[model samples]
Target: MMDNKTLEKKAIAAECFVEVPFFDLDPMNIVWHGNYVKYFEQARCELLRKIDYDYPQMKESGYYWPIIDMRLKYIKPANFGEKLLCIATFKECENRLKINYLIQSAESGEKLCKGYTVQVAVTTSDFEMQLVSPDILKQRLTDYISGLS
Candidate 1:
């Protein structure tokens, strides 16, 4: 685990606004539970872009990051057209990329959903899982975190 100060300095988060569309809702007029995964992806992509390590960059570095595990907890159902604010926070990236997400009402700020995803790096050519993160990832994260000092 990282110390408080290190966590604070290294922390990176991004927020994205989404309006529930009719197509995303189920017969009950509530957003489908599985749709939250897309929300998480949106926010996570934004966070990754902030550090210039988005998917394209990752692939360019010769690694394919595949999600190894994920979890989602729903607190409330969202209605169609309801505005939501999704926040994705970077948690850990030493050996793998771990990101936490929260979905809340844009108007009321009520928490509606929360979840996390863990991704492990694999070589693009051979698809061999990497026990340790690639140097490019480590260096970029280090630079970003150090910049917060």
Candidate 2:
């Protein structure tokens, strides 16, 4: 069985920090639930960029990865001015791209929210859903994983 270290080396992950601003809060002073989606996007973009598979690159490869599904669970509420550490982990990318996200308090290490997003590849010109991922994505991920080891 693969150990944690081996698994970590195979996975692509990136983290970004966000400070809850007053604009993101509702009247109750807690972050609005919908704002978590933006946080997830920020982390996911960083992770994809690390692998050189970000949106622009995907387009250049003649593929469009549109988010087909997404889910989020709130563990705790973030207050205004609270700092959050958002981590995005690439989970799977055989037929589709799946990314998991975790948001935690930067100071307390308490989990604020967690979620995932799944994207399926589609042809840019015809917009037809791809049954299999493009070779470019596989190659990019392969290169990124190899670097970790």
Candidate 3:
């Protein structure tokens, strides 16, 4: 078990609260393993929103940041109707966008799952991947990180 603050926000982070719905459960009465990715996406959206760079903004900026890889480690099972706290922390933006996630029981403060996703920027027009992330990402991260303090 970990404290609630263990996954607390940092300079570039966001937290999302989600309730385990009946549709998200499996026959075994626990959260479906695949649904954890959705949970991470929710937190990731919040994190990107904090930096004023949601999907729409990405499209408008002429780039598409696609998730290239993901990894998850399930620590415990989450039951339906349980309150969950999902945390996302932005980790990198130079070559790719990397965000780490943590999902825990809101009531018991126990870790349920942890993972990370990596995204690389690709030009929307030609679908060419950028070797380095566009300057906008770094600038937005810098602005958000500075504003946090």
Candidate 4:
């Protein structure tokens, strides 16, 4: 198993500011743990969009990538109306795409939660598993990285 520091090394982040809602709170007036998963999903999708290669595009490309593994760890509690920023980073792009996540208080920068997800590519038409991701994904990453240079 990899440690948090090690996982952070393989990520690309998309920061999101979320306003906690009344329904997101538990009986304790803190954000419910399950709600964090939604935030993670939101940021993950945004990060994929940054690369112009998200779920819809993946399917259009004749592939289907599913979340095969996921994990979350809650460190602190956030209350209703609290603004929090979520960072979704890419952890791995080889074999499968792994993403690491971090949620922190927008005001105090206190870490609220951390997690990771793993997704594997599969053929959409025949449903055959792909040992390597499609070339479009690799090309997009390459172009995105080059644009930064």
Candidate 5:
């Protein structure tokens, strides 16, 4: 069951559909653990794209938002050829970008995995880590939230 906090994320999230390819399967025919990061990245990119703050735009704005931390919990094995619905929700963007992710079986709505990633902004030239999220990111997030209403 979803709580209010989680229900809130449904109002502010980006989604994508992915058909699991055979290449993504491990020897056991289940998706390998490491490949989940790539899946998260795809959804993350979609979230950034929705806000018009993807890597290219970030570079143009003179900052690089790199994943500084990540956590994942596997709930079930996803089989090859399964259609998956991936949701990426921008949960926070004050000190860092804290995005939550969910991968569910598109056919049955079973939650297969869940995770979150934290991205920290850094200067493109100096590589100086930012103490707070850059203005561009915060502004974009604000705009996105405003549009949701």
Candidate 6:
């Protein structure tokens, strides 16, 4: 199992806002469970962008990182018009990128859901799986922060 503290190290944390639309609600008027996955994904993407290593850039680097594992847990239900704050952070990325996510009510700061995704690197040229991440990711992350500091 991945530790929260370990994830925090490689994490590029980010927050995202999501409004629960009426259409997204089920018969009980609570946001459907399946929608939480989408929310998690949106926040995870944002975190990746902070490190300058999102999908598009990964593609350009001659590798395709595909999600190979994922898990989610919902603790509460959200109703229509409810605003959610999605938080995403990296858990590990030495051999693979494992991202952990949390969804909370924007107003109450109450956690509604939590999840994680793991992605492995694959060569785009021949679709060969890589045991370790390419140097591009490390270089991009280094340069991104150096430029900011």
Candidate 1, which segments miss by more than 4 Å at Cα?
1-5
How high is each candidate's TM-score? 0.92, 0.92, 0.91, 0.89, 0.90, 0.88
At residue 114, candidate 1 shows an lDDT of: 99
Give the per-residue lDDT of model 5 (tens digit) for 57-125.
999999998888999999998999999999998777767888899999999999999999998999999
Q: Show where candidate 4 strays beyond 4 Å.
A: 1-11
Q: What C-alpha lDDT values do all the predictions have?
A: 0.88, 0.89, 0.88, 0.83, 0.86, 0.84
Q: What lDDT would candidate 4 get against the real structure?
A: 0.83
Task: Give all candidate RMSDs, comma-separated.
Answer: 2.3, 3.2, 5.8, 4.1, 4.3, 3.3
Model 6 ranges with Cα > 4 A deviation: 1-7
When summed lDDT is taken over every stretch of 10 residues in candidate 5, the lowest stretch is: 1-10
Between candidates 1 and 6, name the one with more favorable TM-score. Answer: 1
Mind giving the per-residue lDDT tens digits that candidate 6 earns over 81-136?
A: 99999999777766887888999999999999999999999999999999987778
Tell me which of candidates 1 and 6 scores higher on lDDT. 1
Q: Candidate 3, after superposition: displacement of residue 66 in Å?
A: 0.7
* Candidate 5 clashing pairs, residues 3+ apart or interchain: none
Q: Name the candidate that leads on lDDT.
A: 2
Off by over 4 Å in 5: 1-11
> Clashing pairs in model 4?
11-90, 12-89, 12-90
lDDT tens digits by residue: candidate 3, 1-149: 21123223443679999999999999999999999999999999999998899999999999999999999999999999999999999777778888889999999999999999999999999999999889888777767657767
Predicted candidate 1 versus true structure: per-residue lDDT over 1-149, tens digit per residue: 33334544656789999999999998899999999999999999999887789999999999999999999999999999999999998887778888899999999999999999999999999999998777787677667777777
Residue range with the least summed lDDT across 10 consecutive positions in model 6: 1-10
Candidate with better TM-score, 2 vs 6 = 2
Decoy 1 TM-score against native = 0.92
Candidate 5, backbone clash total: 0
